[model samples]
Target: MRPISLLLILIGCLWSGGCQQTRLSFTQVETPKVPSFTAPTNAPTLAKKEFTPLAPPEVISLSDELSLHLLPGTPSKLVGIHLLAVSPDAPYENLDILHTALTQLSVKLANQRDLPCIEGLTIHPSIHGLRLSLKCPASALAQAVDILAQSWSSDAYGELELSRLKRQLALDKHIRAFNGSEIEEVWADKILGSAHPYNKALNNRELQQSLDKPQLLALLAQTKAQSQWHLLLEGVPQVDDSLREQLTASLSQLGAQQRQEERFVDTFSPYGKQLFVIDAPGTVQTQVRIGYHLPMGLADQEDSAFACEALSRWLGRSFSGRLYFDLREQRGLTYGIYGRCFNNPMARILKYYGATQQQHTGAFIRGILDHLKLAAEAPPSEAELAALKTSQFSQIALRQDDPGHRIEDYSQAIARQAGSDAMAARLKRWQTLTPEELQALAQAHFGQEPVIVIRGDLARIRPDLEEKLPEWQLKVTSVD
Candidate 1:
């Protein structure tokens, strides 16, 4: 028979189970031996060097109208400059929009003039006024200064800019409507009444109506004419005679501007134990903020500075925080949680914030409240306090080399109308603060019924909140 015929016959026999007499054998392989497990050895330590503390900042009066705060360090090639324009006039509703427009105009003007040094310039609107921050090569400092000085005075306000700003604002409003990102405004209203300059809660219509070209131009002119400008130089300890002359010439225009009359009211009516639910329809995730209006501001209660810092750090230090441990690690209620104290010069508010799924909203808020109660009753252990102090010390040490952070500290001091050395004094005091003082501060401020602000699909989250937190009076509101 042919080989094919033989194979087919064998296959048919195997299928029919008729040829199961023969067995084929091959060499067997041994399994590889497993190695025994061993614990890791201790890591080698590096040699410690003697610590050299950074020199205290030197505040110099460059002219009768201008002052400079210089911090000592090995200056970097790229210097950070933080400028603040403080306006005493009534807060402009569209100052933030104007900031954006002016920044864009400045960049356009820079590109046209072939000045690439202004590449990373940024402007931020604070409660006081506009803050301009930028870093450039040391050689280009004079040009950068001129660029910033001229940006505020440029005729950048026109019909085209107004249209662009309106579009941007409209798009932002729509996004915020869906995401419920206006909780800070609610907090401001709750803590710093609606009449406060910081609490200008404008609806979409009001915002659009306030964008007239003439009004914006006038606001810009008023800002330039009345604001007091402060220039903070980082990485520049002492300017040479030539650089000093250039800086003075560039800043004299700003310094000569007339100061506006002040009109500010610090009074606030407290919202005692209220739950505000902002209805953001179709949002699957919810944003929660629980805030306490503290007894005094940082300016008034400088003694509590370290205590407030320690209490805030203990309550919500990310993975190690009490709130995070209870809400996220233990219960898987949310992704992240944090607590922060806003020590503005006039207003002091401690706030805890987090985001959670719709289903976990009630549990998350309840967990935060329960932990706050626990924190109020029991203070941090010695080990916990030690760890916080060590962390804070390390942060301070690291900030010694960072001009940006140094300038920020200086800016805060200036904003408080405290001298440049205010932060240094606070840090000096913090080094000797005892755990008993921190505990006392925590006890006095914690567990007060906080004003709760939640933004979510109210229909879905409201029922659980009512069931879990029957004591909190719930009120639903829409974004204005």
Candidate 2:
């Protein structure tokens, strides 16, 4: 049997339903054991060094954008790459170009480093340009940093790189002044209100017309003056002090102005039923996403996250999950069904999503709601609870398999103001939660009240079930 991660990747590809024919292809991949390579025997043992703590650079707090994460662990032969960019809306517009440039640069840099060991570096750019984060391993960090530093420092394409940097920096100001009226007219038209944060699709012509080198520079200066930039490093305890100093010195060269403090708003919308439809005229299949806002942070309610996860697993995760078995396995009405609950400091949102024949949209929705209602009313059977717990435990164990994951998990928890051990501790807490507690949380949060967002061929789905859905008042919104 394939490892769970590989299995999940395969399932995800199938679930998207982009492929016309389902073909099973099997390949045997070896799973390497931990502690693969040993440290050099002749390497000098350096004394553990500590530096005077410098205050974190004046930068926007991770919480203000999403959660700022920090993960620290024993030093290993891995190098991490993190990109922090500022853009008016989505960073992708610039990053797509940056990625192409970086790919070429990576190859050129690898040859220079004389290290055949370089491979598999991950780069992740965010929806909005708040930050583009990445991670390799500690062993690779020095070489990767050298390549990046040289690239940024080079004058060959310095003018062009600076131009790109300027445009990316403009995003901060645009987001700060994102008044509903202007945003709706410009960017919000392409996104459901609920998925606004994840919507990086920018009005390209409008953005390009509005942006220029002078404007970009002015915004970068403004961001720097406001002291709204900083970088973080975790893992590889040996390099923490040296890396921090090097990063601070490197960034200071940018000559960003220091600011006092930056303020952020905590906003929330009450729970209720809402619908957003995006009509794709010639599309054969519909893509639907259902999400809800949940309380933010781990400590919000006592063990609320664990309870929420348990509920999600029982109703959202497995074929055994309520929606999957009812809508896909038995009814055969949809290709896939699942749920997600993202916990953040500001709010947590739960989502149930699937794709089905446009004709079966109504039946799919009803079946999901019915399963949700049943799960809410009654606690899962002992067998169900055990299965969920086992699954959760297994997933937690799998996360530790990758050094990068460990760092990310730790970093995220710290950024969220949750302690470093929070993830592992939460797993332990979940084990002790009773089925009654899970049911009560479900009753309180699920089925009883939820603000729903549906984006699909509503014309086909709505006519059949508009009257069947409960008496709650409904508001309809169109996607242009």
Candidate 3:
């Protein structure tokens, strides 16, 4: 009985020991500290430091107010001012009010005693607001900023002349309007297509009659108090902590005001094909523009963009571009030739333009189409590809030489919804593309039909040329 009891006790001890070993084994196995799977903790370190917000020159209670951006450079400075207000459902004619406001602003800026210190001043108006740009020697930026800030404040414009000037210039054509010559030709072309919201350009007559003081006051009364102004300072010197604080304090004084949102409508041709001709009689040569709609943004296919770049270089882009070689060099038919594909989120248009001898206009058009066909069919040779790559890379490098370019590039990339690394990635992708890939892209995009416009003496070439291009119906209009 005793021996049996001892055997039972030994078995019990062995079982208990085995259970203890199992627990120890699990403990030794260890939980992994997965370095690769760990969430990043250094994001704050990697993030760019935020700019200290600065006080604006002066605080204006008016809904529409000017905001300034001062970018300090090595030996000069750039100043940018944008007028902002809030008016949603404003009449199309109200643009005249804004136009007049801008003209008054420009005249004031141009006449300022401080103007002499500025190296250059450029006053232009866009859909958003009046743009006042001034550049001066780098050392002068601080002083300029001080002067501008003071002038923009409420006390700067005195009570005496506001009413008198408004009455005198109220009917003045030049004061209230933009010269037709000042308008970009492309904007005019778009205006010709549609007479709606897309037609934003102001002519002399509309500027004179559109907005009076009462309307302006009414619009201002409805303006939102918060700011819609965006201030961008690029290529500015890195300010020390003390100076940065001062800037912030000065800029913060510019009170907040909401900006008006401008709406744009897309314009399309009603007819399958339309031709408009402008007659510039004494011009030595004709200018031809061929436009086509394309996808608003880039394609997902990497090769598509590469192909476009290569085709552009080979055909009309580079110094030895095919158009120049064919039309200007070999045939001696034109003084210059070029093609451009202008792209935006809303539209993409391809245009081929050149100055050709009046006699060769028809031949020049034919030659351009023929070359485009050639690009579609043939792959670029290795030599041509190398040249294009070199040219593209060199151009990109040259663009970066300016500090302003870096800021602009970053801004545009943000606007386009592309990644910050887009420039570097595009270069890399272009480097990897093969000749076959580019050829395929050309075959896809370059073969489409284009809408053509010619500016020249229609009587000189019309009857004969119209017979040759039967597909293109021509309408000739005198410039006068």
Candidate 4:
């Protein structure tokens, strides 16, 4: 009851002449005890289970120059045929043109055949070279393969209109000029030189003069003649014998060619110049990329591979990385940030990039550099290391269940020339990885000063950068 109400009742009792009999009472109760939690005196440590690696894909040589790698998938109605062609001679631009041509031809063939092939007939440029994928219903697998083979042999795009293509190029360039990440282009230019074939810029004038029906045909002919091809079939049990024979005949049409040895290009710049800026006059935020060219790929350094993976995860693995915690959570400098190992056929780049407000760009860069320094100084904690290893194992298990992801992973392995069992070997190595080993690797690799690329309004960011990182040399350039 409220105090006011109690007083009113007391006054009423006093007025009624019954105040002497009115008395207050009190009661006390004992408090209950919380149950004690006794720590186990002999808690058992988690026993490491021995990992059983997935069986490597079956490889069968279709011809002296061509091979088919098969990985059985769940008994499903769909199947995937991935054709990989690798050649240093094939420029990405030409490959892109061929991809467009082949895509159009595939659609035409599908329409003509009246095959309900609506899902997955695609081609794209990969780090290895050109990748063409045909995922169609298993019932139509042979027909789909025949369609693709026929399309490759056909001269469907021989009458392609050059003027129309040039107009499309102009529109594409216009769209990319405003929509694309300018920082990426600048980064490529800096890392792989402006004149490098990989860094070749596509301009309307150059494309107009060079790109046409004849050029496309010549490139296609060259690819068919010189490029080494690897075909992978992943789906269902037992690809029919007739289908195999058809594929073999189609591949045999192209003359036997030796696998071209990957030419090593000296891609990395010497570590001296540290900072570069590309000016974007009207931009409100800055794009920052900082990284170094690794000496070699993980596949080449088997002993240090797991350690490198651990280091990468420690530096940046989405939200779990230290870079995210320090730069975004602690300082509120940027909305997102990441560090990763970019594996190319010729170059292995360890890059960190993100975007931030113009004013915070300098601090953001500082935070990244500081984290790299910290990585060199100390290893990840036991908890962090444990989490990273768990994620690795979990990814392996999960990817194996999905046939699409499995095929992609297998193809990537083939592209890197990292054998079919690379992940299994990595698994074996990861079980024995230690914090001290990771620290050593980090000190060796992460201690170096990395090249930095910043793209934003230079006039706005320059002053803040000057104040924060004045010791670093700043090279400014106009956005291309």
C-alpha RMSD values across all candidates = 13.3, 15.0, 31.8, 15.3
Work out how many backbone clashes candidate 1 has.
Answer: 0
Give lDDT tens digits, candidate 1, residues 1-480: 699999999899989887863321211211111112232488665455433456656776778777666655335567777667765344445565666577667667656655675667777676555778778777777888776776665354442367777777777677865455688667667766667665661343574656776766766776666566777777775788888788778877674667546656567655666789888877778899986777653465776555566667777767667677667776777899998877765466777899988877777787777777766665566666655666566667677657666666556656657654565676676566666766677777774677888888887777778776888888876545
Q: After superposition, how far is residue 43 of candidate 2 from its true place, in Å?
A: 52
lDDT of 3: 0.50
lDDT of every predicted structure (CA atoms): 0.67, 0.50, 0.50, 0.67
Off by over 4 Å in 2: 1-122, 127-143, 146-157, 161-205, 218-267, 296-302, 470-476
lDDT preference between candidates 1 and 3, better one: 1
lDDT string, candidate 4, 1-480, tens digits: 699999999999888978663231211111211112233689876667645667888888878777788777555556777777665433444454565566665566556566776346777566456667777777776666656555556365654555655565566556767874667778877766666566652332464547767676776776666566787777745656787897887766555654456654565655464689988887878898987766653455655445446666667776757777667766677888887776555556677888988767777887777777766777666776776677667667788777767777776676567866677778877777777777787888776677888888787677778766778888986445
Evaluate model 1: give its lDDT. Answer: 0.67
Backbone clash numbers for all candidates listed: 0, 19, 14, 0
Residue range 92-180, candidate 3, lDDT tens digits: 23444444454454456557656565434443433323223455554554555555444335444432244543454564545423322
Question: How does model 2 score by TM-score?
Answer: 0.62
Give residue 455's lDDT in candidate 4 (0 to 100): 86
TM-score of each: 0.81, 0.62, 0.62, 0.82
Indicate which candidate wins on TM-score: 4
- Per the 3 Å backbone cut-off, how many clashing residue pairs does candidate 2 have? 19
Clashing pairs in 4: none
